[model samples]
Target: MPDSTRQRRPFRREGPDLRRRELIDATLRVIASRGMDAATVRTISEEAGVTPGLIRHYFETKEDLLGAAYDQHMTTLIEMSQQAVEDASQPAVRRLARFVETTLSTPVTDPEALQLWAGFIQRVRRDEAMRRIHRTNYHSFLSCLEELISGALAARGRRPSPDDLKRLTIASNAVVDGLWLEGSALPEMLGPDELTSIALDAIGAILGLDGLNDDLRKELDK
Candidate 1:
């Protein structure tokens, strides 16, 4: 039986972008806390405080929403890393050093973040859409690293050719990725300071920018 005048509540309207972001954030949280298997539309809707219909309204399928969530996660990580390298006042070498430092530090190198990444990475191979998103984000991050490396090399008056720049970027990225994984997975064993120091040393050596060690020491002392 329906009440004649029970003061029915009106639904609050949210912008499409806001709604989508909320859903994506909810998906990431669910995946990070539980596993990807637990990130169903019903679960995500509950997390976002929305109706399951709303999720279907925003996304055609569960896979689409998962892809969007992965996209948001990777975009955020890349933006944070890019922002770290965007200090115009600092020289290129220092900015590059900052990028390394930022990537190996909190929020970016977090355990929950690692969990979210591990969850999505499993789908990256078998899922075509997820694979595309992963490839796009990987290149985006790599491009950022390449730009920083180019600028740092130019600051040292050493202009690497296109091939050399690509190689340098790949090698530097490998160092950062390796350390980021280890630090995120073993936070107790690898503190931020140690992670950044090892990353800068290894990357600096590869780039022939030995001065990076001194730069890092100065930054830490500050």
Candidate 2:
């Protein structure tokens, strides 16, 4: 006779990091589709296919989860931007050009990304944790830009002083941020090609590298 009760297969539990990320992703989706006010524990749990208690187990408070989500969102943006600048085989100018092109393109400049950012920006002003995350991510992005700018300028035989490089990085970041905001908020107003061209031209002029746009255009043509 067969055993009356076969042992059930052991359940596979999700790793802590993955579970946390899933929760954060769920939170973003809820906020994206229905605004930040709808991203309650219960709602996020439903989206993540877990119980509200599971959320509480991972995050002590709703604000903590929100902060985590914001951190994840900003960190992902910085990472993608870094990845865009990672091709060492390309010349520094082309690398900088790629960085600008990727930043101004889809996913990075999507309406949903803008929505997610807008949803978190207000909280960043009031919440200390959120503000810290913002500052850290902002600096990470600036460092990447500064590195690319340094390489590009050096390639052109123009090595800027540290102070000058600092100013240039800030200015370049401002241009990219402004254009990114406009492109994301009003996608119809400027296409990706136009945005990339304007960013490359503006940053190139700032860094004294006049051929960035031309270089990128030539690469694309080839």
Candidate 3:
């Protein structure tokens, strides 16, 4: 059975500002564990150890709450990916690994995220706000990915065209997203650590790096 079949972690209590944040998080968890249709405000509130009215208080409506939850979920994930690139004090290979590591690891790359993503993907087809949020976050993640791939290409002296870079970005993003779903759903096979390595290796290959071990080799040789 997928590890996701079991509870990943229980939502814990937090401070007031963080309290609402926790509720939003609980929304994702509830949506993940029970599907969006079953993820009622009461259920999310219960998951957060709060009352349903609290959700209405913050969001004023179920649709509003769903939109907020979607935004928070994708934005936080984007911030983590962007952080990995912007905080680069290492070589391009290491920086690229950092991007892969930050993205394909636990917390961000988990069943809960996948479930919430699936739920949101459905909404994106008919929900305007959800579609806009999804597209914005998608571009942001893609842009960062493109930068990392471009850096890898430059490091390996590969002059991929603009179209090539765009295609590479899409492919690499698919690799990461696919690994995320697989690793989250089937931890026995696609565990976080293994997925991280697989993602890094794939990126390196597409960008024409000799292999994904360059960063690790440099560290060990130091």
Best by TM-score: 1
Given candidate 1, what's the lDDT at residue 110? 92
lDDT of 3: 0.78
Residues 1-222, model 3: lDDT tens digits: 122344434545566677667778888887878899977876676676666676777777788778888999899878877786685667777777777887887778777777888888899999998898899999988888888778877887887999989998898888888888898787777776678778877876766676665684465478
Pairs in steric clash, model 1:
none
| Quality of model 1 by C-alpha lDDT | 0.90
- Candidate 2 residue-wise lDDT, 154-221, digit = tens: 98898989999999999999999999999999999999999999998899888888989998899899
- Candidate 1 residue 179 C-alpha distance from true site, Å: 0.8
Q: How many Å off is the CA of 131 in candidate 1?
A: 1.2
Q: What is the C-alpha RMSD of each candidate to the true structure, in Å?
A: 4.5, 6.7, 5.8
What's the best-to-worst order under TM-score?
1, 2, 3
- The whole-model lDDT of each prediction reads 0.90, 0.89, 0.78
Give per-residue lDDT, candidate 2, residue 103. Answer: 90
Model 2 CA deviation exceeding 4 Å by range: 1-12
Q: Which candidate is the best by lDDT?
A: 1
Clashes (backbone N, CA, C under 3 Å), per candidate, total: 0, 0, 0
Better of 1 and 2 by lDDT: 1
Candidate 3, position 143, lDDT: 87
